[model samples]
Target chain A: MNTAMLLLTYAVVLGAVAPAMLQRASWVERAPRLAMAAWRSLTVAVPGAALLAGLTMVVPASPLGAPLARALDACVMMMQDSYATPQRVLIIMVALLLSVAIITRVAYGVGVELGRAWWERRRHMAVLRMVARRDVRLDVLVVHHRAAIAYCLPGRGGSIVLSSSALSALGDRRLAAVLAHERAHLRGRHHLLTATARGLRRAFPLITLFATAEREIDRLAELAADDAAVHASDRLTVADALLTLADDHVLPGPALGTTPHDTGQRVRRLLKRTPPLHPVVTLVIALLAWTAMAAPLVAAAMPAVATIGVDCCPTR
Target chain B: MRGFGELEAAIMDVMWAAEAALPVREVLNRLRPDREPAFTTVQTVMDILYRKGWVDRRLEGRGYRYWATAGRDDYVAGLMSSALKSSPDRAAALARFVERMNPAEVEELRAALEAARTGEPPP
Candidate 1:
């Protein structure tokens, strides 16, 4: 129950549980990368928490410091006492749970506001207009000579924009690949996923797990989109389509390419012909992971069974 | 007049139709019988046209009066050249568009261009 004991227990608990949680939440193949990143972020944070716990052992003077210092001392004493009642321990746990809840609520509010701002700033006009021809009725806008540029703006009935220059730069096969890729985005509603992930990240800034999940999921979503493109056309055509656009200057925006996954990843994935998903394997692994997480809490409750039985008799 | 999706055709349409510096509104109205946009929209589109060196705009009244700088044949040729500058596949799109043109359509464009260039017919 002393500060060091409490700190060490917390560190051990967090270090063990965090990795397992990350492993379960992360993409099966990419779990190691997510775990390592999570570890690095946690490593910096855990030491500071341990230091705070260590400092809490020393009582201080001054009216402000007296109350807080005494509270810490009492908490330490309760934790250090081997025979401390389960009810007292439960009280401390409830306080910590409340703190986590408050922090989560604040984070979510921030994320929602930030997400709304991002959605507004990332403007994409659905109507495609060209500066050249007065005729040629078409639904999507096409700039005359500015081919090698294409992007899907997010919204209801969002149109895929392409410049005439882009149309000319890409051969038929490559053009088909580009259309298929953009279509995949439209069909799957990738923009909504990106927006949701961004909002979650803004809200839970401290929890790298949420942000990491969003980033990896975004990349995976793109990969899924690339798969759609491949299905629509040939894999090589999709790869070639990416290569053409890769060299071209990207449209100005934040959500465009901040994430690390790109054309190269898409092409490499296509070349390897990665299995999209194996349903049975995923289900089994998910079940086992959930069981592992639940086991410790169930076992921890066993020691208090006698106390619970005694409480039933009341004052004898 | 109406918003041009392609510059050459737009320029050709303007040149063939207008004898003087017609305002953007006049041009737009001449182009589309179905939907008439505001004067500002037409002017903005015309401004883009002027910037692209597709048409000539002269100061007239409070607004700028516009005229196409290229004749029908010249504009069509420009369109062909611009399409070629696009990807090789665009060359196919252009070729297909061109193949659909009748002899009379080709002759009319040539005649218009010749008339714009020379005041009189060939002797």
Candidate 2:
């Protein structure tokens, strides 16, 4: 019971508070992949810890030295003192309901979103293959559009799509920067991250952690791609490419009313040449994220840990 | 598979340019002179296109003549429409570039970029 309470508290605190703390950490923009890892771990840790805490309530502890399987089986033989009271029985029932609800909802949300995205991409690809010309030398799809647009579709059929106007506007090096950025998105499978974020955020809207995951993941992904683009082309070229496309796509009026947080920030960050965090700091973040993901499972197994390998008779 | 896709786009282009449905012979003729594709290859690509719903076909005389179901503009529009949809699916940015920024933001971005390009501090 104490272990379960500890886990429940951990989940609640992590879910309710982590987002605000993370946003304050300025390194997030500098180390986007790490920030994304942190968010990914938090989403898993919150639900995982909650589900485990609920499991601890529903399943009674086994005899000393018994394994986890034995403990699970012991639940059916509910002659344990833990289940003796009517209140205890009610608590277990509620906990069981919660665990089941969490598992099913998460599964349904992610499954439906992934499937819908796959189907949508298929329909889009069907049209794209027919309309777009394959530029084997550039290794991208080219569409004859006046707008200077660029994008990539992700999956087996996915390729970077560049507009004819965009092709003419950018010089070879500037185009390389843009291509590298899109390729980075594809390589990182950022679409899957964005899709999963949407699923989780919608699944648990009230949970602040899940609620903010989609937007943060999206912004962080673009930053990460920008970072990757720098490896191929200098920051100045990437910034130039961005401005050229923006210049071509700019409309006259307020139809472009502000949700300009990401683009503006990306340009400023590139211009400012924000220094990346130290390698040691990045290593620390990656380790911390892994540890966060692993901790919930350890907490959930606290009871089993107490029972296993304590064969005192053998010691005697 | 790459060859088939290239051929498919090539064939579709001929159909889009033609005033009416053309037989496989006509499509092969319209293709660039650098590479001459076989008549059978053109027929096979149009067959695949018909199945994929990009083009519709009917038997004229002995051979099938294919015409695009939609124009080039419509397909380009379809691709752009999905990218531009304010849906959550586009959260990953189907277009890795712009995401419909306000004109003010675009201006701000251009100013910042210009400063970077010219090595001048922002005014």
The DockQ values of the predictions, listed in order, are 0.03, 0.45
For A1-316, candidate 2 gives per-residue lDDT tens digits of 7777888899998887888988789999899999998999988888988888888877645222244444554433433667888999999899899889999988888887777778878777877887887899999999888777788888776899998988999979989989999999999998888888878876787877886777788888888888887778888777777777766543233334124567767777888878889999999989988888898777666665554434212234
User: Which model scores highest in TM-score?
Assistant: 2
Residues A190-285 of candidate 1: C-alpha lDDT, one tens digit per residue: 555555445545555676644565555555555665666777786655655665654443332221233223444555545443553356755565
Looking at candidate 2 chain A, the ten consecutive residues that score lowest on lDDT are A307-316
| Model 2 share of native interface contacts | 0.55
Candidate 2 local lDDT, residue B110: 79
Cα lDDT, all candidates: 0.48, 0.78
Q: Grade the docking of candidate 1.
A: incorrect
What's the lDDT for residue B54 in model 1? 63
Query: Can you tell me which runs of candidate 1 are displaced by over 4 Å?
Result: A1-122, A126-140, A145-147, A249-261, A285-316, B1-28, B31-123
Best by lDDT: 2
Per-candidate TM-scores read 0.47, 0.87
Stretches of candidate 2 exceeding 4 Å from the true structure:
A62-85, A249-258, A309-316, B24-48, B58-64, B92-95, B120-123
TM-score of 2: 0.87
Best by DockQ: 2
lDDT of 1 by residue, B1-123 (tens): 223544334433655668887876677777566555566666776787688776787787798877777654453334433332333223111111111122343344444434433553332
